[model samples]
Target: MELQLALDLVNISEAKEVVAEVAEFIDIVEIGTPVVINEGLHAVKAIKEAFPHLRVLADLKIMDAGGYEVMKASEAGADIITVLGVSDDSTIKGAVAEALKQGKQVMVDMINVKDIEGRAREIDAFGVDYICVHSGYDHQAEGKNSFEELAAIKRVVKNAKTAVAGGIKLETLPEVIQANPDLVIVGGGITGQSDKKAAAAQMQQWVKQA
Candidate 1:
């Protein structure tokens, strides 16, 4: 399993500082939707420029103009870009095609997709690099999680690597690891900690063991 640190609420400088602290522990540094919205793809560019060794993901959650968006993000140095699972199949395929052309990747985020298993199977067939099971902040506030959803995708997805995200914490990470997701995304779990580096190190150890 690979550990991904989601930098959602931080500014460009803060994101850089936090990643510098835990860079060795993480495989991917996610410039989250909010960060991208706030700082634009400049956030992706800056992070990748600063940490050239680590993979950077731009969480576009793209719902339209898939090919163009993927191309733009890839040009901005994003190693992987995201598209909504609920988007049209053409959109997903467009994103994947662009990503392939750019030598990057597309992660289909199954946040609000109702038929996760069925949709994941379809998206997997579309050649997405990763099919992510995610619960947004709103759903997480209602005590919803992607654990079960992750399992559902794992059971059905054949071609794509599986990822899980949504309020994952140190205590709950083992549970997520039990499901064997290819990527485990953690945001507040590491960012909200008093000692971010130690927290990330511990989480990385757990994921490595898992």
Candidate 2:
């Protein structure tokens, strides 16, 4: 499993400073929704330029103009781009194909998705590289994630690679990985801490054990 440290709702300089230390430990560095919305794609460029060795993902939560959004993110140097799983087949296909053409990977976010099994099948069939099992900030605070659901999603989409986001602390990493997600995205767990390198190292060790 790989660890992805999430920098969400944080200022760019602060996020970058944190990333400078943690980048060596984590497999991927994620620019989360609020961070992207607030800092724009500039954050993606800054992080890419700052940490050339680390992988960067831009969480655009793209819902429209799939091709354009992917292109914009790619121009900003995002190694991976994300689009909504709830989008129509054309949108999903468009985004995936564009990312492929640009040599960038696409991750489909399954947030607020109803009929998740059916949606998983659709996204997997559409050739999404990953299907993220997400609990948005509010849902996580409400205690929404269950290991049963995590395991079930992995089972439901046998073809698509899986990832989990929201409220992923070091304590929860092992249990979450029992479902076998390829990656773990954590926001507050690492970025919110005073010692980011230590936080990232802890999560990295936890993922290795998982």
Candidate 3:
């Protein structure tokens, strides 16, 4: 499993500092939706330019106009762009097509999709790069997680690599790793810790060992 560091609620500079602290431990740096809203695609560009080696994912969580949005994010140097799975199939198709043309990738976020397995099965046919089971902040506040949903999708999704996100932390990481997801996404798990590098390093070590 690969480790993805999610940067949410941070500006361009803070995001840089955080990533620089744990750069060696992370496989991907995520420019989260809030960061995108505050800084625009410039956040993606700045991060990608700063760290050309690490892959950068722009969390657009796009719901429509997938092709145009993907094109814009790809232009800003995003290696992977996200789209909401609840979006129409055509939207996913458009995003996938645009990403392929841009030589980038699309990760479908199943944030609130009611039928995880069913929709994942269908989206797998669209040939997206990743299918992520996610629980939004609100869902997390309600003490919810996507572990079960992750398991649900793993059983059916064949074409896309699987990812799991939503409140994942160092303590709970072993449980996540046991599921053997292709990617493990952590936000506050590392960012909120007293020692970000240690947390990221430990998580990366565990993932690599797993």
Candidate 4:
């Protein structure tokens, strides 16, 4: 398993400072959708340039023009880009094809997909690098989580690696690790803590042990 820190609510400079504290412990640094929307792919470029050792994921949550978007993000130094699971198969295929050409990766985000297991299986066949089970902020606000969804995907997904995200804190991480996701994404869990470095170190240790 790998630890991916999601820099959602931060600007470019803040993102850099946060990653600096936990970069050594993290395998990937996600320039989240909000950050990308606010700061543009320049956020991806700046973060990747600053932390050359860590894999940088641009959360485009791409819904259209998959090939062109992936190409643009890859050019901006994104190692991985996200496309919505609910997008058309052709769009997903386009994203994966472009990612392959660029030698990068595409993670299909199953955020609001109603048929996660069915769609995950379908997307898995499309050769996406990772199939992520995610809960957006709104759903999380309604007390929903991706744990059950993660398990559902784990049971059905064959080809693609699996990932889980949203509201994953230290107290809840062990449960997530037990599910054995390929990647575990945490946002406010670390960023909201008073000691970001210590929080990240502890989370990384748990993930390593699992």
Tens-digit per-residue lDDT, 137-183, candidate 2: 88888989745555657777877688888787768877887777888
Q: In model 3, what are the clashing residue pairs, if there are any?
A: none
Shift of residue 37 alpha carbon in model 3, Å: 0.3
lDDT digits (tens) for residues 1-210 of candidate 4: 999999999999999999998898899999999999999999999999999999999999999999999999999999999999999999999999999999999999999999998999899999999999999999999999999999999999999999999999999999999999999999999999999999999999999888
Identify the leading candidate in terms of lDDT.
Answer: 3
Candidate 1, 1-210: lDDT as tens digits? 899999999999999999999999999999999999999999999999999999999999999999999999999999999999999999999999999999999999999999888899889899899999998999999999999999999899988999999999989998899999999999999999999999999999989998
> Clashes in each model (backbone N, CA, C under 3 Å)?
0, 0, 0, 0
Residue pairs in candidate 1 whose N, alpha carbon or C atoms collide under 3 angstroms? none
Stretches of candidate 4 off by over 4 Å are none
- lDDT tens digits by residue: candidate 3, 1-210: 899999998999999999999999999999999999999999999999999999999999999999999999999999999999999999999999999999999999999999899999999999999999998899999999999999999899888999999999988999999999999999999999999999999999999998
Indicate the worst ten consecutive residues by lDDT in candidate 3. Answer: 150-159
To one decimal, what is the Cα RMSD in angstroms of model 2 from the true structure? 1.3
What is the lDDT for 208 in model 1? 93
- The models' CA-based lDDT, in order, is 0.96, 0.84, 0.97, 0.96
Q: Against the hidden reference, what TM-scores do the models get? A: 0.99, 0.95, 0.99, 0.99
